[model samples]
Target: MASIKTFINDDFLLENKYAQELYHTYAKDQPIIDYHNHLPPNEISDDRVFGNMTKVWINGDHYKWRAMRTLGIKEKFITGDGSDKEKFMHWAKTVPYTMRNPLYHWTHLELARYFDIYDLLNENSAEKIYAETADKLGSQAYSCQNLLRKANVEVVCTTEDPTDSLEHHQAIAKKDLDFKVSTAFRPDKAIFISHDGYNDYIDALAKASGQEINTYGELCEALENRIAYFDKNGCKLCDHGLDKMYFESYTESEILAIFAKKRSGKELTGEETSKFQSAILLFLSETYHNYGWVQQFHLGALRNNNARMHRLLGPDTGWDSIGDFPQAEKLSAFLNTLDSKDKLVKTIIYNLNPADNEVMASMIGNFNDGSIKGKVQFGSGWWFLDQKDGMTKQMNALSNMGLISCFIGMLTDSRSFLSFPRHEYFRRVLCNLFGAEIQNGQLPNDMEWVGKIIQDISYHNAKEYFNF
Candidate 1:
């Protein structure tokens, strides 16, 4: 027998017996409601088959690419210019270095669940696993549609650009597929003008909305038009990615002046830029409130700092890092800005820094008026924290600070179908926590109550929250 097979049989879910039982009860039949992800609508529309495991798993996942780079693997092995087989080989070489990272667990879980192969990926087993996975890829069961079905995904909401046609989304909606996938309205490109391509983006927005872009008023109108389009297509959520919340206010004249300067091809000072962005966020938030849509903010990421790598490889090529801002105070002020005006929409705050987990968790409670106990939620562990320790910390913090029963569960936040395993990971962690409490007599061993809580977090919470 293979050494990997021995490890799987001896230790898989056995490390926590209560967890094993909980998984059997809650996880196996749960329907996945992925409320946030980066899956392209076109692929889902096509119901495509991945050419191989490498393309499905590695092609666009910056997380794996970052790890590969950290291991001194050449760019060719990453997004650059390598063959699929070569990239897989490089990833195989880097697997041992993952060690205690969540990536290690995620990789092994994927191997066991999908391919039913228990080989630890290393130089020795890399070729064998690769060939075996490739062989399976030739079957219809391994197509992207089949992969999603096998994961038991009931719905997925893909993050989309403001300028997107959403033709692919419409196409998928027309299909007979079981999963009800849709798009979330993401308008960060229109909001962030500090980047080099602001002018180009403004032009694109004008074309998309069929409105002039000479003034701030016109810009707001154009945005409203796009938002309306998204709403018409069953969009009930809006997503924003920012370093932190902006609560600063600006006079109409000040914002209009900044717009004029930009329209005239003149650069605004940093203060002016901040005012413009802050004003735009306020406008957009109010729009969300009017539509009764949930607004999601993925905060505290410092993106594109590596100018050299960014220039060479383009954006989202792993040039981003975490930012250390006093997120709690600013974030509170931002929410309060809306709350005070009675214009706050349903909101979820996701933070990148783990140290701020407790603070972020508690911050959500401050805004929860008796209207909804968990209405303002601290979203699942996101980005860099999408692993075991991170998920555990998030769940513990939310449980300690607020009612975990109201919590919406895990989302992939991934660009790959293989990432549905993330839901499985979250389920295992959740069950372990509940099981431990029961075993330690922290809670009565009423399996029925505990099982309901588990199922609620796993599926029911998201279902009710997102209204999917």
Candidate 2:
């Protein structure tokens, strides 16, 4: 019998020789532009020294939490009061069951890439790998900033709310680190008018902007104030996570009345909520355009599905799923609304459902207008769709409908420090797609041009698109 090969070798996912060449020669060395993620800027600023694998890998990682829960592991070892070692052990036992899932690939890839440990994670090897990582993580070389450096990350943008002070970002700027850290303004809280704590959040926004919110007009003013502040602080982009685009028509008086009723703790009718969300979202988008900032909309998430678990663990604890919202008409109308006023800035639209890949792919071309090279983008597969099959479908859709050559490629959009290997995963997948097409004679065997295109998708495109 033949012996089993190494699980995560250099050409792990590169299938053909051309695929291997493209990845190694072009895609491997490109510095990553993790332009969107939920990594806490405070950790980077403080250069946090995480003490163990549990701290760096498992802590607050809903990806792992979801896996552990699916494997019949109890909440204690997953997210509750279990000891860190216990949690790491539980994770190791669960790793073998994750085969064929992206989590499995991500798990071993992170171990190999970050720790230089090529051993597959499982029950047999868990304790040894766990101890090895614990020792390295406890050392100074594994500090948060140093870990980012080890990944060869050139620029990374962490998301922040409108009310954020960005003190950590400021501190990082003060230090001149090798990598650049930036902020993207996320105003989801402000747009979510009918959410549970809208009024209280508005009050916080009021304090953040030094303006009292008494009317719909005043609310817009406060948001604009925050936008100006964010722009002054070197913000080049903004992000929105929504079920779908809202384009409901509303008069100024109607929006004002709705804001007043909500502020007074009155319940808003569904129509009233839609109108308010539409108005605020449009206002924010226009302001982003005026400031020449790229805007990203992560659409189609049905959040907080399991009410009991959600209430127990709070948001982003993995109770969310892809929402099959009707996207095209409203999304088109929303972008057209801004385009009619010539206020549509550089835009990226990410769809969570793979079924809408074609819709999103075609939607971007409607507004490309040749003013910029791929100005509006059908973004890479996101959220539930960030895996191999989903990414392949997204690239095929974009290549068929638009210019994949101009594509600004992968982002972590993750909360864990160990998630940077996701970029490598994306690059390998990207190269294999191009290489297969070359082998099939769909295009000439022009390795030079193909290599350039692959490299651009890996790094240069995002850098030029975001101008980071």
Candidate 3:
């Protein structure tokens, strides 16, 4: 008789013996360095215990919310006042329908890894899984901090706005825990002059930095003050989310005039807006170089497509998609500007549009002056492209265009603590790719050397890159 294989078996994503050995030997047991994510710092600081599966899994997960909405589940059960179990049951019903979507694999992976409930989630199994998970979640062993420990996380770097207090990160630093927590400075609001409530956000930033900003110079000073504060508090990186890189030319006087106009609640022309954005982005990058911080740009997201839903539910509620922007010209100009000035810090650029995979991969090579290993990197696939196909294409592009051995591997980039399994998912995919190549005689049969490379991509490279 043949043995039965579970939906998420030991060899779930591994297709052959080489893949299994590589994963189990080199990829598994590697500590995670989640260098970029959106997890709430307060929960980790407080060590809060999320008492049920829905609270920990379904709530605030726009990924699940989007899927539920597509399956015609009502908003009440998805994101509104419905009971926790009700939302989960609705999600469970949508799981089978999520087949061929990354959600199907992610859902089961999370379930099996976190809750130890290996049975596939459906309407019939929902009740049992929910009850079992709720019981486990209600324990002290499942607190926010413990959840991270379960995932073997070594360092988790969360993203924060310029105005954030970072008191939670400060608090976490004092703890004697096994893992470390860091933050990334995200000043997108400060650079986006055309966004709604931009002035209001400026006011908040002023308060946080303890400086008044009536002029463009004052604005730069305020941001610089905050960067200093973040650096003092152990922030090692910064992140930006943009439709595309901004590289329009402008004079200081022009930028100052644009700032004055926007601050006075006066509308500016498209040219003025682009010029202001370009100037501020340049200023921030220069400041980041001075502080010796890594800079990351996540480009090509077409956010908030559903205006009506956005008005009702707010941003990041899963109304975003990939954007088709002319990335190369502006991106090349922007990086070249920094490189020419000799002020380019270690940089990673992530793209959401699959069409720009090779474009971004090749673009990073121009400015990689070899002062450091993988100095300017085409970052891993992000947002909509975090799936298996997306990750594969990104690695292939980088391998063909640049060096994959020095690639800083996966990050959760997720809001949920349970999402750490994504690192494992990425590792499995990476091992299978190399393992298949070895099997086809595309490369020499050197398991030791290949395994070492796999380990670097899995864990060591990021450890060296970030110095964490």
Candidate 4:
């Protein structure tokens, strides 16, 4: 227990004096700009409080779910009918085994930061910690909005589908909250013509937009309507999750014919699918540019791999992994098309595959064009790569290829409200990197200038880049 305390102490990840000073001085107090995440806006609007630890922490955390499954925990105790306490116990038991995993750090960081419970979460500490968190969670002081306040979050932009009402955002706006809650338009379903339920989703989109979609033009108009609605509701950004970019050449008439065939319940060929996706994606990007909105692309996730498990548990239930898609040529073509038309908006690209880190790093440089500061950003390490080693590699890649000082850094991209400490984790890692360089005399001992850059990467850059 004493060793565990020392392990997670104030200078947890900071190994040297310069590293500790950089973190505690310049980076520790920056307000979080979580520009992309999957938190439910309704929860923030309603200010709902969880009943217990598992309800808030365990339920819907696919990261933890994946680790537990890998350790052979039964489905009954994980995402099944087992009681909340039972599931939590299983998680607590799994903590010691998660030693080298990022979960180990995140778990303790969340517990310490949110609950002030520094004890290592395991079989021995689970009961006491569970009871303590449950007691605090039941209070109004620990409600969803208050949780964001505890993290000193300045702004959080939740992702919503085009079919969303944004009523919750309206509800949140009505109150005088300390922090701001904005939303992003996610049009993945509208673009995925080859996926099952594509037409069904179009029906939902039509209903939401109050437009009838009978043709490709109508589909675009309906999407445009939703975009207008989202923009009116204070959405300054949009997000897309795709395996890779689609740059297939197709005429407007060809896309129209493909849409007509898909609407007729005929399965389109792979070529047709790619063409339709490319057309819609281009349309969406152009529209976003017109609205002056930032666009984020989360690419290379090979989602829902285990069909057997996916069928049983549904998507995003620990079934996705990094994909090795060839991202260079098509991505360049897509961005070049937008750039040529002078319609490329502020863009951030996140690649899940570590192999493409340098590729993504250099790719952003091609379109920067001196239009804006870091106009096309190689985004932070995401999903499986949002850890110490991964973040270091990503920073190193960007530093090698481009300007790291101009880099806008770190977002939770998480569903859990308690996950805000990830920003702090990123700060620690970032400071350590800069501090290590200074100590090695590779960088001059200029704390103020360097600290300003640290703060910029930690908070200021995103604040200015998103302009939210």
Scored by Cα lDDT, where does model 2 land?
0.92
Poorly placed runs, candidate 4 (over 4 Å): 1-3
- Arranged by lDDT, best first: 4, 3, 2, 1
Best by lDDT: 4
TM-score for each of the candidates: 0.96, 0.98, 0.99, 0.99
User: Of 1 and 4, which scores higher on lDDT?
Assistant: 4
Candidate of highest TM-score:
4
Candidate 1: Cα lDDT at 58: 88
The deviation in Å at residue 262 for candidate 4 is 0.5
Give the per-residue lDDT digits (tens) of candidate 3, residues 289-355: 9999999999999999999999999999999999999999999999999999999999999999999
User: Lowest summed-lDDT stretch of 10 residues in model 2?
Assistant: 1-10
- Which RMSD values do the candidates have, in order? 1.6, 1.4, 1.6, 0.8
Model 1 lDDT, residue 324, Cα: 82
Which is superior by TM-score, 3 or 4? 4
* Tens-digit lDDT track of model 4 for 311-425: 8999989999999999999999999999999999999999899999999999999999997999999999999999999999999999999999999999999999999999999
Model 4, position 350, has a per-residue lDDT of 98
Q: In angstroms, what RMSD does candidate 4 have relative to the true structure?
A: 0.8
Q: What C-alpha lDDT values do all the predictions have?
A: 0.86, 0.92, 0.93, 0.94
**Per-candidate count of clashing residue pairs (backbone under 3 Å):** 0, 0, 0, 0
